[model samples]
Every structure is written in C-alpha cells, then in structure tokens.
Target: MSFLTLLDYASVLVFAASGAMVASRAQLDIVGFAFIACLTAVGGGTVRDLLLDRHPVFWVADPMPIVLAALMAVLVFFTAHLVESRLRWVVWLDSFALAIAVPAGTGAAIELGHGPVIVVLMGMATGAFGGLMRDVVCNEVPLVLKQGEPYVSCAMIGAMSAITLVWMELPLNIALLVCAAVTWASRASALLWGWSLPVYKSRPPRQ
Candidate 1:
C-alpha cells in the first residue's frame, strides 16, 4: 500500500525470480527453487533489518513475502525451460531487483534517521546480499564479487542520489524513484554497453 512496501514487494518478486532462474541453471528441483527464491527474496532485507534492529524483521512481520517467493519459484520452475538463457534472465531480473532494493533500503535507513553513510551501506547490502547468498548457495560465483562489475558502485550511487534529493528537501518517494531509475540505468548500461570498472592487474616486482 505504501511506497516503501511497494518497493519491498517489487524487489522481492524480481529477486525471487532471479533466484529461481539460478536454480533452473543448477537443475534443481521445485523445493530447491522455493528455498533459493525465498532466501534471495529476503536475504538482504533480513540482514538490513537485523543490523538496524527492526523488530520481528520484515519477512517475519508479514509472511506474505515468503509465500510470494514460493509462488514465484513455482512459476519459474515450470517456465524456466522456455527462456533462451537462464543466466541472462537471472542477471537482468537481478538488475531490476537491485534497483528497487537499493532505494527500499535507503528509505528504511532514512526513516530510522540514520546518517548518510549508513543509508548508503544499507542500500548496497539490500541490493547485493541476496544475490550473493543465492550464488553461494547455488555454488556459483557471487555476482557482487565478479571481476570488473560495477554492481556495488551502482548501489552506492543510487543511494547517494536519494540522499542528495532528500537533502534538497525533495519528497522521499520522489527521491526513491530517482534512486531506482539511476540504479537500473547504471546496471543496464553495464549489461548493454559493457560499462565496467577496471580490475586489478598484478606485475612482478622490479621486472
């Protein structure tokens, strides 16, 4: 009903679908799909809530998120074979999830009156942790740790965008909209235009 609640549900659905896609890639069963989907749907939010000391956590407060995740997993489990590339589906779905989640997190921290740095960190955690957990549990390389990707940068920039807008006295909902826009655009650019950060290169000393 509320903007923050909308963001949370949107992120959960998209993230759950992404997690199910990963399960499809791993050839996991329906139960595995539900497990991974629920994990990925709420993992970041759970971490954020625990760190912020939100009572009962988000999912515990309302179990609908978990039920929604299971439903999404079921849908994906039956439909995954139709996708040309499950990996691409996972990445793209995750991009959308990250976009929504970063703002959701930033808004939550801001609502709690946390400072800007904490806001940004919570946003990044919300955008990244779910996918990281999904990948680790699926025995895949975590997307957050992938070389040359700007995932974390996108999250930080998204959160900062919200902070800037709020500092200028813009409405929180409007700021969150901007946050999601920037987050998705940044991630989409990386996927579509090959935008990336430079990775470390090692060289022999005194060569």
Candidate 2:
C-alpha cells in the first residue's frame, strides 16, 4: 500500500481506539462502542470528501475502514478492564490520530489540485472534526472547544507545515513525517503541561 493508504488505516485504528475508550467510560454496550468507533474513525474524512466532492465517499468506497473500526471497538470492549486510565489513553491516542489524519487530509486536497488554503482547511477538518463529532455524540465537551487544549491549533500547524514543505519541493514522505511530528509534539505538550491559548473574557452586562 502507498503511504497515504497506510496513514488512512492507521488513523482509523487510532481514532477507533479513542472512541471505544470513550464508550467504555460511558458504560456503553457493544453496539454503542461500534457506533462511536465508526463515527470517530470516519467522521472527519467523510466531511472532507463531501466538501471535495469525492464520489461514493471514502469508507463507502472501501468498507475496510468501517470493519477495522468495529473490530477495534470489540477489542477495546474486551480489554477495557485491563486499562486503569481510559481518559488519558484516549487523549494520547487522539493526538497520534490527529498527527496522521492531518497529513492524510492535506495530501488528499493537494492531490485534488487545491491550493494551499483549501489544503490547510481540509487537513484541519480531517484531523479535528472526527473527534469533535465523537465528543458531541458522547455528550462530552469537544476537545477542540475545550479550554487549555490546543487540538485544532495543532492540526492547523501540522497541515500548514506539510503544505509549506511540499510547496518547497521537499519529499512527500519527509514532509508528512515532519508535520506529524509537529502535531504530536504540540498536542502531547499541551496534554502534559496544560498549555493553551489565551481565553477571551467578555465583561458582564451592567447590573
């Protein structure tokens, strides 16, 4: 398989893992696990494909990603008891997924003949929207909107980095790796150190 195809499958697995972890925390059953897993695995890519007008969608064109996500959910269901910290595991797993998916999305857009702006937007959408959908479905605050987290920002930076490197004629493999590294490092640092952008504070209405 090509590198992009490999990244797609890897992102599906990691995102599915994170989704299943969340389902476990919510005391969801097997079907719930499967639903969340599939959603988180394909939500962002689905959106990106639709926006880009890709026919049949991606997971629809190839059901392997869905099957893989369901299988991952089953594995997580069976092994959740062995994990002492599902929440932490979900965050870390999501960070890695973001790293992979960002480049996957950006690369897709680039291949579609889009310029850098769309490439960056598609990359961020692919990296962050799936998790956003996952959290919304799970009834948790989406990480992208959460305070003291740099989720979307990390995705944007990674996407831009990849696009910039490619624009500079760097090897695609090298660009992908460097972008993934930037995303992973930024997200991991945020999770480990509570790093975040400043919040906008609005004044209260006059009493």
Measured by TM-score, the strongest candidate is: 1
Q: What is the lDDT of residue 204 in candidate 2?
A: 69
TM-score, every prediction: 0.97, 0.96
Please identify model 1 stretches exceeding 4 Å from their true place.
204-207
lDDT to native, each model: 0.95, 0.92
lDDT, candidate 1, 1-207, per-residue tens: 789988999999999999999999898999999999999999999999999999899889899999999999999999888889778888899999999999999999999999999999999999999999999999999999889988999999999999999999999999999999999999999989999999987876945
Compute the lDDT for candidate 1: 0.95
Pick the lDDT winner. 1
Q: After superposition, how far is residue 113 of candidate 1 from its true place, in Å?
A: 0.2
Clashing pairs in 2: none
Q: By how many angstroms RMSD does model 2 differ from the true structure?
A: 1.4
Clashing pairs in 1: none
Candidate 2, residue 54: Cα displacement in angstroms equals 1.3
Cα lDDT over the full model 2:
0.92
- Candidate 2 stretches greater than 4 Å from native: 204-207
